[model samples]
Each structure stands twice: as structure tokens, then as C-alpha cells.
Target: MGVERYNDLFITEKQKIFISDFNNNVKYFPDNVHFTLAGEISSDPGNLGSGGGWHRDSPYTNQFKTIIYLTDVGENNGPFQYIRGSHKKSGYKLINKVLKEYDYGENRFSDDEILSIVNNIDGFKISTITGKAGDLILVNTRGLHRGAPLTEGTRKAVTTYSFRNKIPNKFYKT
Candidate 1:
């Protein structure tokens, strides 16, 4: 198959359009990634807050990612969770607080630290997205988000990481 055909197999029209528009006219490369089988990450997926904890992809830059669920995802199967309005709310207050505790490259946050900031902002609700296989999820990775810890069963997903400018590759454990 041709290169465009290969991309067509994974990049939906909406995904292409959104990524292009979301990052303005900047260039982007879509990476179709399949990973994390059952028992691949950890025998106990919910191993404390070590793996699937709350974080922002690039706390100081714009980041976009699209995910497709390859398996049924319930609360216990590691649903994707987002702190609504986090992409735009809290402003420097959030960044300042996080930077003081963590460097820009390491942007993971503890539950108490994240909650303490968002709680002050009105309309910032936590949205846990649980869906069936083949569901498409678009996320602003610069916002505070995470995959809920799995307690039973397994969760598998394919992700497309989009970037405006070329940068070093980074991957987060599911």
C-alpha cells in the first residue's frame, strides 16, 4: 500500500483535521502506536501511583494526543481521566506551584497537589472516560490527565502522538 493509504488506515478525517487545526499551520507527524498487552505493564496494574499517575505531557508547551481504545474499558480497566478545564484554567498559579515542586521535564503530580489547585476553580470536574473498543479520544496532553489504575481485567489502546515542532520522542506508560 502507499504511504497515504497506510496513514488512512489509522488517521481518521477528524483526527487529521483536529491535529492540523489544533496546532495551527505547524507541521505534524501522526504516529500509530499499539502497545501494552495484558501483563505487559505490570501483573498488578494498580501498583500504587507509580505508573498511571496524573501528569501533563509538556507542562510548558502545547501538546496533543489521540487515543483509540482497543479493548473494553471500565473504571477498573484503566479508563482515561481528565480534569476538565485544566487545559485553560489555573494559569500560572498551577504552573508555578508545580514547577516549585517538580522540574519542567518531570511534571507528574500527586493527587493532593492537583486536587488542591483544581478545587479552587469552579466548573473543573473530573471526567473519567470509559468506553468500548474502537472509541476515539482526543486529548490535550498539556492538561492534567491520567489513565485510572486497573484493578481487574486488562486495557489496551492505540495512541497517536502529534507534535507541532520536531522534538525528542517521549512515551508514557499506559
Candidate 2:
């Protein structure tokens, strides 16, 4: 994380707000994980439009993410969408069972489809996560989420990942 990275984000006072928290949270990870990448989605006309579908993070061990919204988000502005408490329900056994041969995001399903899988689980709630300019969302790695279309202005955000103490064997090349 450098000053230039903060400059690229269009939020007000994003550097002071996010950096302070980022520095503190960095201590939580074990030696295997390093804070990597600080940038935004480069897709042109870049609001990932509606019904973007459900997906996971990296395919190896479950991952965690911290998202800082540099702008206000609402239903029309493509608010970050996620299911609360979904992370606690997922585990390596279930991940391996469903993805025996397929990779993450490869054999993806629709939100409705995925919701059906866990609909019966207690305390499930899907939402269009709205937040203020400096609000942060802490996400579990295997957490199910996706981009919803923005009806208005661009939704600016910065996302970074966290991993377990040991990098997965498959993350290495042959």
C-alpha cells in the first residue's frame, strides 16, 4: 500500500481512513499471508451490471477480504451484495465436494440457485449492502457474493485479500 494507490481511489479522505485500519488489521494475519494489490476494477463503463451471479474468491483455501467503499452506495448505485453469516456455513469439506474438478468461478451458479442450497439454513439474509463513503465490509474468503448493476454513478471501492498460514499446494506451478 503506497500513497499513489490511495490517490487512484476517488473517495474523500480515503487514504487517512483506510490506511489507518489497514495498518492495524495487517497484524491479524499469520506469516503465510501478505497484503497484496491495491486497485480498482478496470472494466470500462465499469459497474458490473445486474444479476452478475454468485461466486467465491480464490479456489484454494478459503480467503478473506476487506472492502472499503470510497463512495456512498445504494440500491441504484450497485451496492455490494452479500449474504450475512454465509461464511460460517462454508468449510473445506463442502468446498472440495462441490468443486471436485472445477475451479472457483468456473462452475458458478446464479444467486437464486446458490440461495436454494442454503435457504433452509437458519439465520440467512441476502442484502444490497449500502454504506457511507468510509464504511468497510469484512468478508470471509469462501463467502458467496457478486456485483449488482449500478443504476446511477460509479461505485468506487478498494478490495484486498487475506489467506491462511500456509499457501495451498495448488497455488504453485507445475
TM-scores, each model vs. reference:
0.67, 0.60
Candidate 2 local lDDT, 126-171, one digit each (tens) = 6678988778776664666776666677666766545547544553
> Compared with the true structure, what per-residue lDDT tens digits does model 1 show for residues 1-174?
112334454545765566446445433334322222121222284454213688887777656666667678887777889886676645545555644655545578888876776666556667999998778787777788888777877777656555544434443322
Whole-model Cα lDDT per candidate?
A: 0.62, 0.56
TM-score of 1: 0.67
By lDDT, the best candidate is: 1
Among residues 3 or more apart in sequence or in different chains, the pairs in candidate 1 whose N, CA or C atoms overlap within 3 Å are none
RMSD of each: 6.0, 5.9
lDDT of 2 at 127: 68
TM-score of 2: 0.60
